[model samples]
Target: MIGQTFNQNRPLSQSLDTQGLKTKTRSFWVPLSIFFVITALSITVLGPQTQSIFDTREHIVQLQQDNRVLVDKKNKLTSIDKSLLTRQARIAVSAIPVESSGLAALATVRNKAFSSNITINQLRVSEGESSEKDAAKEVRLQFEISGSLSDLLKFIDSLSKAAPLLRIASVKMVGDGVTISTDLEMKTFWAELPVSLPPLNTPLNQVNKKDQDLLGQMNNLKAESLGFVAPASASARENPFAPY
Candidate 1:
């Protein structure tokens, strides 16, 4: 009887020990699993959100920098005198027109020759060649003229100060030194205005000293233009005899 009692107590004690171990394991594993799940959620969900916030902040900083630059440009632009700017703009346009200005160039030559007392014998106009691509288109003018050598020299010198920017390509003089017949090959330039504009965000650069001097030179050039008188409009009478 004693041995049986001892065996029964031993089995009960063993069962109790196993139950205690299982309870401890469940308590440790529950908290560990919860921690692992929370860690995975943070990596999968919160990580991208944090990165996006940082990227947006960097973009905002870039935008602010661009805004400051634009503001500075605006200030500079506003400080310029409007009338002086307008005059410079006109001078530049008159110097290099946006279209083929062969007629205007011819008029300038005719006026200058008349003023210099040089008689033009023959005049020819043709297209000119450009050395660089996308450069100004040139109009070549061939002129045959007769005048006193002093007058011819005066005319040639005056051409440099004329508008449309004439370049003397060649000159040949014949006859006595007092009265000279000359062949003049001259070139004038024009270019089509830009059709495309830069983006609004592009940085603007003010005209530099070199460009200002160039503009001043252009302003000194004289342009001759032909004038036309407007015709009077005729009124119609109810009867043809009303005119009499």
Candidate 2:
């Protein structure tokens, strides 16, 4: 009886020990395995994506900076364009006019000669050959005048300062001690009306130093007015039946 009891107790104790060992394994190894699985998922799934997100943010910042720079450049270009247009308008006003004709130019020369006390013997005016590509038309004038040397010099100087901007092409002079006979060939310009303007995107050309100097010279020149016509009051018929 004593031996059987001891055998039975021994079997029961072994079974209890085996159950405790199983409980310890469930508590330790199961949690450890789960932790390892979660760590592997993080490394495999989220690690590469973290760097990609940061790179995308940096790229977006760079694009924003480039956009700001382009906007600033656009504003500056707009300001420059406005300034150029204003200057161009002023230059057009001071430039040789398009409305002038050979008759008008001849009249101007006659007026200048009369004012200078020079006698004009012969006056000829003609239009020069012009092409479609030219911006201005050329007008030629040949004239003969007689005056003392001092008076001739003064007349020539006045011509240089005259408006409708004459260019002296040639001068032939024959003197007979008492009076000098001068033949002059002069050229002047008249602008053609613009048919169309160039495209807006065309690049603006900067004025050169020489052209700027010429503009300054023109600005300093005195303005010349076309001779005034008498008002209607002066020409009105004092008698209603004068002429039609």
Identify the leading candidate in terms of lDDT. 1
lDDT of 1 by residue, 23-106 (tens): 879878978899999899889978888899999999999999889888887888789889988888889989999888788789
Against the reference, the lDDT scores of all candidates come to: 0.89, 0.75
Worst 10 residues of 2 by lDDT: 198-207
Q: Best TM-score goes to which candidate?
A: 1
Query: Model 1: runs farther than 4 Å from truth?
Result: 1-35, 129-134, 227-244
Q: Which 10 successive residues of model 1 have the least lDDT summed?
A: 234-243
Root-mean-square deviation (CA) per prediction: 7.2, 13.6
Clash numbers, per candidate: 0, 0
Candidate 1: deviation at residue 40, Å? 2.7
